[model samples]
Target chain A: MTQITSAHRKLRIILWSGAITAAVLTLGLAAFRMGDDPSHKVTYTGEADIRSQFSLTNHEGQSVTEGDYAGRWQLVFFGFTHCPDICPTTLAYMGTVLDELGPKAENVAPLFVTVDPTRDTVEILKEYVAAFHPRLIGLTGSEAQVAEAAEAFKVYYERFEEESAPAGYLMAHAGHIYLMRPDGRFEAVFLEGNQPADALAEEITIRIAKEMRS
Target chain B: MIRTVLIAATLFATPAFADVTVTAPWARASILASRPGAVYLAINADPADTLLAVSTPIAKAAMIHSVETGEDGIARMSALATLPLAAGAVVTMAPGDMHIMLTDLTEKLLEGETFPLDLTFETGGEVTIDVPILGIASKGPVEATQ
Candidate 1:
């Protein structure tokens, strides 16, 4: 083989270096743009597209829709005042989380929607929610309204009869606390016994930080 | 009521075996006019047994119930006629799971009060437990010494 000339070797090296620089610059710019995109900032694990729309009555006897809670992060739970165990436990946990959040709690709203609206009237909800976190809003409406709300949130609830239960009826419902973004999109869910208040506070704090950054 | 109390006391005095014991029986405080509340406890039985029924004078009726989460993730409670306890098994009736439901309360259960409960077993016979009243937000039974 003939020996290569110095000029020919320099040309080959410059072309290869230029190609490498272009690729690196393109990838860097794309990653920077992705960081600026709000949708790509931080998505919660197990995010789903659950519709958030409903017309219900708040504990204050005021008619409310999802729009009433616009522009704020929301923590929503479905339960009834008549529920003895898990409902109260979750509400207390929410109270503790809010208390731990301190002033940052102002950026979030907690809602308790009654699965059994037949017995949970506005007055009853007002009393029930006040016992928990002062900022918690209790929502209840007619049976049809409550059903529609539960449906929109993908919440499962059914009232069944048990011979030994009061009036032979009790409501069986999912015990999940749903987190929604300020735009009312489903973000994540916390199972009843899985996450404690301190961990919940950390999650909320992280999400709020990501949102603020975005 | 007097006779029921006496029977409960006698039954509690003689446990069928040292291993068969009820621990940390507790109930949630029921609000005004609310007809039903739930009791949670832990039961440890050796040589196996079945929980046939539960009774309490403070309520019109009491029964065992278990909350099941469907594949769709909805939770619902169903009456349990008998709960089989495996040999050397420990069963916990806690929030969001199996529990003893008390209906038609004679009086509202107040926090800091202890009430009597009678549990009938298929093999271990019957035993009485003093269920303490816990706060509505309590997740588990408070220890007796605590």
Candidate 2:
């Protein structure tokens, strides 16, 4: 009993240290790409067994709990509807991967959670995200909700105005793609730059297979 | 509109004043059958002459697309009835602004490779440009242009 208690105390101390470190890393403000190294690439931090339980709304306007995502892989993109180009391109690419994977696509859920929640309401998200890939899901919520979620993910975004929209707009945003596993643990992240479809597919396959074995 | 005229005039010019060049030529390739491949090339059309639509063997249906994304944010791409090249006008075809959408690609457009694209204009005559393929990243900062 004494040994067990000592082990329990050690585990509790480790958990507390981890929580404090994570808090310092997450400043509650929009932060740019977190894992960029000297190579200027999206470095893999391995899958984080994230226990963050978030309740948000899907593009379908349905209440999605963490349980709904319990048994599949997920590719989450933080973007907005106003993104005329990149958003659609990434969705189409991911959709193509899913289609090519076919039955295997069942293991993956392509999710689009808007960092710009104020403009990306459920109704608009439904029509906009659907235009790219039918399998894509959009998520949005209140300002505080979005800020909290973004803080958790370490995403950075700001507003900018082009000559076309001199009246202040959205554009300045740190773009990154986050990959997650079924148990809701963070997997890998793909940063800006070209990624081969076959490579991505292969990588996910490996991760899923490893996860299964684990 | 204004940028092209000034740049086109400064390039190679004949005594009669007719010079043409493609400014930004970007080609988009996709494996999705539902979508068409897009290859955009900007031509500096001489105001003294005009530019007529050319032909493309790469696509089953080819036409200069006049595209616009309206207030609704829905992009509408239509066949440009006519592309007027005032003697000193240069066309700027870019992403989210103006571009060519190639439909029903014959084959895959591999990255770092170039393919032959023919453009027949009224004054500049037939100009075949080698369109290079760019790899489209899944998402993020690097995929900005795609």
Candidate 3:
């Protein structure tokens, strides 16, 4: 009876060890697969798994989505009006880029999405965007809606307290301009300070011409 | 003779003490009166100095700030207590880089207008400059039309 009991105990230990190893291997493989997922990658160029979707309110206070601007290339940028330097510089250059595009600018929709919805109301956004360019449209929404839109584009933003700043706070955000294709796909990204207005315009013009041919 | 000699000394002493030169000092027109504005300029210090403080009459407070872009593509702006200037090195403050942040403006910075900015240095004393208010889309002081 003692011998039989010891054998059963040894068999139980072996089975438990085997189960643990299999579980660990399965989890490791799953983690590796997740790391390899395209959607998790953040890249500068090429086909990134970024979805073009946002439910936001335009500067005109109209509720719009990605579907509203279908069949046109979308040049989306995220920033706030209160931003004193970077945002204004980017918007200013974006205006120049659109102007350089000439009539081809009609095929592109430039959007300025606000990361600070608490301070950027519709009226404020209207005036701010007007100061930049006529073709530029400003978008703002509730915090949740804005978060959803930012996540869809893989844009990161965070608010921190600043004693000397206006309204006692400031926001740090990504300054990349995402170019989305007409079919709701990411075509490319433009980083501020990397290229001048003419270079950006030329790149966009080339992509637009390619789209026309295809 | 004494009065003429004192006048001559004052004139020569002023230039000798003023070694820091500022050029292309300009500010962007604000979209709203409630929003803050930024001023950019190039500083050339002949003897190397430290920027102690900045003040403007148009705003309640002016502070020196630096903007740095992180590897994650996020731009972060932080206030600097003092900015050191190397001798003969042109420290240029431009948009998306180092700038003077003007907060609590008394009025909107209208395009085609100008304001005064006073910068104090540890060794160079004070230099007051008239900062022009360019259009919001102006890339540089010369490119205001563009």
Candidate 4:
């Protein structure tokens, strides 16, 4: 009986250690995966790593850069004029948000940067941006310049061919609206589909007030 | 006698026994003549049916398109061949989801103008509806805010 009891205790100890080892391995694997996935990284408000540099032309046939709008908060949105649904919807709500901002909107400058530089020329962008809001400015440039701007904002865009589409192609892009501080730093990012106009307006207002206090 | 004939013609044009009902049809006004257009609407079918095709006189090509956001947070637009509707079910095409894409527009879709859209269904046959052109940023029909 003593021998049997000792054997049982040894088996129990081995089973417990095996279970602990498996648990630790699973946790370590998960941690490694989380660290490697870019989507897992949450971009917090005022993250300094995101740069807001860009050298592009305005809707008006003149050259412009980030420094042109230095003293005003920039509402930067990346999209193309040919985008039928998502881009227009975002811009429309953004216009409403601007209206909701009331007089405080004077400090905000909304910029629409085209991801499809090949199709969205300066003339097209001027008319496209005008349909949404008067204060909204459209920006476009050479392919390399647009790429640099998109890279700075961490915006992803790709053009794919669709046989049945009218333009024979379409652009897949990230629908994130980046809010930049007056000092041209990243302030906040808004998902186009996630927030309503009123809620977005409120959030922007609060952020602006916070910046003012600081 | 003329008024009676006009009433009869109107009734014959829109059959009362139509199984499919389309409402709140509206399209965003195009910024330029060359730009494509998008239309949204809600459909209710008494019996199950499949949407086979869509056509509009204002555009050279009209097709049903769906916008899906992948796990990477990229919005991709793809062409859908058909849309299935369940019996007595209401399918709504909105801004970020399913929509009708009008490409190679023959003319610019100006605000306040109405255009005819022909929707062909598998069981319900073809139904033509007038779609109003709203502002580029309009959510839906003025009366129906959805």
Candidate 5:
């Protein structure tokens, strides 16, 4: 009877040790595989690093930077007032989106950055933005300053002329509304046509809630 | 008396002799002293016609442009020299689509003011009509605040 009990105890100890050893080996292999997998590695590419490098002037003729719009989400668009169709239409859409947001809209700031610096002056920008939304801020600067800002945003713009076009000419630019977090990280982009006010409002509301939680 | 007779004939004539009529002509008021603005109108023709050109004394230059939505959904304007209209068809020019590009305004176009736009047709000659100015956000004649 004593020998039988001793054999059973030895078997239990062997099983317990074997189970613990297996668990430890499995964890070790997982850690090793995670290190070998490139997808598991994290890379940091902060989008706002270039936004801070730009300095432009608002419609008030005050020098403004990314810091001026801190503490709130930024919705930025690059366009000019002379743009007869796209600029006004898209800005009006944004106005609708912001209006739909109501009080929560206070958390987002809409910015209109000019691609045509030569023609879009401070006064023109002031009146232009007012035509769309009261909360919209129009920004313009010198040629070089505007170039730097456009480069930072990676927006494409070009001046093209027609056979009998006016001396002032016209500009073709990428039409995109960029959504940025308060920390200046780019969150998403809204296309020109598919965006409805209610849809955009829903997306922004969700993002704001998630951000608050984090 | 002859001019009245001709006018009556044009309006009362059949489809074969009916002339094109321009309606719902409106433009957006400009805030800047010299800024571009767009004018929209609807052209109704009983017979086929072509819009050759448009001119206005309010702006130094006027051109016809068509705004096309690319696959990416961005609207881009391309200049058009002439626009062809089909018989019994109505061509409507509106914002974010086809429009008259009024460039380098001589003076600011204020709200509630009216200006003349001269539209030249290939066979119908030129017609001068008063285009009422509305706020920049006005979408059409009905929404315009006169």
Candidate 6:
């Protein structure tokens, strides 16, 4: 090979450095796009499995089941009636997000399932839910039935006695939104309080639209 | 009723309303003529003071409460004798959170209607405000974020 000049050597080094950097960056981007390699798949607890069923009562006191919302995409949130803070806030957010979806939102039902059936009776749920969105369906059942449904959806709830409390007892439960397929199959989960990279309505609309097309 | 007590107390009035001053109130208002609930209110203050107690004419007892959560995820709300409003601090009485508990309400709080509430402070003095009810009129002992 011809003898390389000092300037040529410097140029070669710079070129090689840039090429290597681009290659490494490309690899990193590809890895990130893979969304957690198989070896590192994230394990989420309390996820509702596919084909599970629960018997409950809707806010209108109508007997219902998981299959009641089969033909359309459904977003389900498990919360309690006594939850004055998080539950209503979540429902409000969910309502707002769904409302943002507009016409496409019609195919996606946002469900508010009560974990505290002891207090959130059919009538209570109707009044509570009516205050929010007209479409929002609040479902509740007996304690045992609610617990079974909660387990299937992977929710955690417990009531602590506050002997000194003058503001009635309080209940604490999980904050998670379950996105179910049109056929009532477990699809994916959107964790609460996550500021998603994309708008929730857009993301869910895309998923629902794609599922509808299929 | 708190109003009755206040009126009765004022009937024995001695002029010293200068020691306490409660102000800067924000909350929901009753916009309707008839409602089945109560309104919420919040306040802010500077210089340490104690919200000794609250009185309201709308209910038999209006207690100052703060939200609390237990280790097992149970949320509870209890009355507070004094909520310290430090210098440049803010106190809120919102839905599903810390609020002025109006028990055994006497009047029907509808949208557009304003009910009176009296809050007595140890240092900042006393303030009477109208808390409008605008939240869901449903039972909520389960969804606690204390």
- Give the candidate number with the greatest TM-score: 3
Native-to-model Cα distance after best TM-score fit, residue B78 in candidate 5, in Å? 2.6
**lDDT over C-alpha atoms for residue A54 of model 4:** 94
lDDT of 6 by residue, B16-48 (tens): 322222322222322121222323444444344
Task: Estimate, for each residue in B1-146, the C-alpha lDDT of model 3 and write its tens digit.
Answer: 99999967875454334356565678999988888899987776656778889999999988888888898889888989999989767676877888898999999999889888888887767767788898887755545532
Question: Candidate 2's residue-wise lDDT over B1-146, tens digit each?
Answer: 89898766654343333345454455654433333455655555433445566555766544565545443233444456457766545465544444555554577555666677777666556667666665442222124233
Per-residue alpha-carbon lDDT of candidate 4 for residues A1-214, written as tens digits (9 for 90 to 100) = 0111111111010001121112221110000010112234333576676667999999998999999999888899999988888899888878988988888889899999999998899999988889899999999999999999999988899999998775688999988888999988899887654655666777888888988898
True contacts kept of each: 0.28, 0.02, 0.39, 0.40, 0.20, 0.08
Clashing pairs in 3: none
**Each prediction's RMSD to truth:** 22.9, 20.3, 23.3, 20.0, 26.1, 20.2
Interface RMSD of the candidates, in order? 26.1, 22.3, 26.4, 22.1, 31.2, 23.0
Q: What is the TM-score of each candidate against the true structure?
A: 0.77, 0.52, 0.82, 0.80, 0.73, 0.64
Instruction: Put down candidate 5 lDDT per residue, A1-214, tens digits, no spaces.
Output: 0111111111010001121112221110000010112222222234554352359999989999988888899889998877876677678778888898899999998999998888888988888888789999999999899888888777777787755455546777777787888877677777544444566777889889999999
Two-way DockQ contest, 5 vs 6, winner: 5
Which 10-residue window in model 3 chain B sums to the lowest lDDT? B11-20
* lDDT (C-alpha, whole model) for all candidates: 0.72, 0.56, 0.79, 0.77, 0.71, 0.56
DockQ of every candidate: 0.10, 0.02, 0.14, 0.15, 0.08, 0.04
Model 6: residues >4 Å from true position, as ranges? Answer: A1-52, A163-168, A185-198, B1-41, B60-81, B92-97, B133-146
Candidate closer to the true structure by lDDT (higher is better), 4 or 6 = 4
Global CA lDDT computed for model 1: 0.72
Best by lDDT: 3
Error at B114, model 4, angstroms: 0.8
TM-score sort, best first: 3, 4, 1, 5, 6, 2
lDDT of 2 by residue, A26-92 (tens): 1111112212233433446664543324567998889785578789888777776554344545566
- Where model 1 places Cα greater than 4 Å from the true spot, the runs are A1-48, B1-19, B142-146
- Residue pairs in collision within model 5: none
Alpha-carbon shift of residue B68 in model 1 (angstroms): 1.2
